[model samples]
Target: MTDAPAPKHYAPRWNSDPRPDPPAVGGERETLSAVLDWHRATFELKCAGLPPDRLSEKAVPPSALSLHGLARHLAGVERWWFRIQFADEDVPMLYYSDEDPDQDFDRLDGDVDEAFAVWRAECDRSRQITTAAASLDETGVRKRTGEPISLRRIMVDMIAEYARHNGHADLLRERIDGSIGV
Candidate 1:
């Protein structure tokens, strides 16, 4: 089969996505995959075009939920689920050390561009793994647990992850600026 066209990267922002829309009535795999992609894009939109310091700010008092933290966590989440969990690729943690378990959310010291780049690479690799899988039922072993996981479950979990985190992102963005909705 011929290769799919190279994806174009347009820096995303609230209500300004260059990505394609998902089908309203596609097959199970198509629909699920498309929804996953949409949620991922939503996460990006919520964090786009913010200043580094703004991104790093923990908007909610006593809750370490910054847009920067969300980006870092989501990057690790993508790598955890797709690379370590789904593709079974040997990889190291994106953040978080034994002493700093909340590094992704707590220690926001890295450059924003570097964090975004890591997240983008993970997203691209995730799409590749999903595309190459034979079906949603395709199984991969979980790294830490040594248990089996299905692509279907991973997709659903990822959607939930984005949904939950995007909520935090929305609040963070609103706090950063008065803007809301995407």
Candidate 2:
């Protein structure tokens, strides 16, 4: 008798349960936080439970856009906006060194856990900074560019940036396997 092929093992989808609708907030500050939360959650959902090879897969030639890279890039994004811009701290950028600025997405020689750990650390830092701020009206200066900006704008920009990257992640994940959705 011929042996049957084993069924493929698909990674479990991240947080498939739908979130309860956000409660009404008193003002724009609360609303902005809620939006940011949603974006963050969505991004996390895309990367959850992916294996190392899958996370670091270079499906597209000449492009280093892997799940690990995305996570690393997002960590850099948080460090730039929250740590440098908002906290007024002088922190060196991660994943981007002498080699290439695009190294954030470039596949490096590390286990999947390392990349995810870095990503989670940055995400937690971002949440702490955002949560501590009194309001979106808080003003801050960009460290590198020396441009005047406000927390409100940063919050909005973060959401937009994350949303765009999340779209890319969705397609990448789908290509890796067949799983989809939050």
Candidate 3:
């Protein structure tokens, strides 16, 4: 009996490129909000219509980077910057443990629905914390490091971080499937 050849693997494709024209903004919202919104939308676009396995699949063997892992990392980062840093609350970091400081990106055998739900919940919480700032100039000192940080700075940092990771996710997703942008 002849053995069939292995199925060819296809890369991912994105519909809307990140280099597209920026969204139009009017009064009230600052540049920070616009940046955050762009990153958030990009993240959602990268995650749309992906199955749990694809979302959670590791791009590299034994590497802690995956679409789901990126989502989880962002969730933890949002909590740290907004809740702990901005709100000055003593809350435990999500998915963090002594054994793994970077549990956010660690390989986990979790369902896709659970990951999506967690990501959505965290995104909502992040928006709430960001929107509550009295102004872009509002400052909050980090409890752990005592470094003074402004809401504007935090939001900008978040946007930058998310943008970078989303780029990685885009490439990874493409490698996983022929699916592309939103």
Candidate 4:
């Protein structure tokens, strides 16, 4: 008989969304990027096995936030900060416009699989950009202000943003079912 595919191993009930903790070794770039990657994986893990309908579900009511929306929102944020602001790449907004500023969350009109693809691409690009940077002190101008923003500041801000939003993801995932942790 042909070799059988390996069986999937699901996390035990006691395992609350565990992920690889941030690296204990490496320089600033390595450590910061590792932690960011961990947070990114945590978000994906929180969304693991969720159906599209549930991902799009605004189960909380009165709040437009959904995992699908958060994915799109984070994609836009990644492009905004890393590509537009730091890399100085000229591009249009991936989602949202003056007339539809909150479209990322307010309206779920497209294929969520596509949205996740876009988010994943953006996240990968952001990591690549961070990796290629000469140093954390390298500066880029703020989009709204001509004032400069250091790569270090951007990293810290992004970490904080993800941390806060992951908390939201936690509650959202739990509401969808009862998954928690990381």
Q: How many backbone clashes does candidate 4 have?
A: 0
Candidate 4 lDDT tens digits, 33-114 = 8888887887788788888999998878788899999998989988988898999989888788989899889888899989
Worst 10 residues of 1 by lDDT: 10-19
> How accurate locally is residue 41 in candidate 2, as Cα lDDT from 0 to 100?
75
Q: Write the per-residue lDDT of candidate 1 for residues 1-182, one digit (tens) a residue.
A: 97999779754355656557789898989988898888888887777787888888888888988988888999999999989888989899798778888999988886988998899999999999999999999999887789999999999999899989888888888888876875
Give me the runs in candidate 2 sitting further than 4 Å from their true place: 1-15, 18-26
The residue ranges of model 1 lying beyond 4 angstroms of the native Cα positions read 1-19
Model 4 CA lDDT for position 17: 45
Candidate 4 local Cα displacement, residue 159, angstroms: 0.6
lDDT of each: 0.86, 0.79, 0.75, 0.86
Q: Give the Cα error of residue 164 in candidate 4, in Å.
A: 1.0
Error of 3 at 141 (Å): 1.9
Kindly report which residue stretches of model 4 are placed more than 4 angstroms away from their true locations once superposed.
1-18
Worst 10 residues of 4 by lDDT: 10-19
Count of clashing pairs, candidate 1: 0
Candidate with more favorable, higher TM-score: 2 or 3: 2
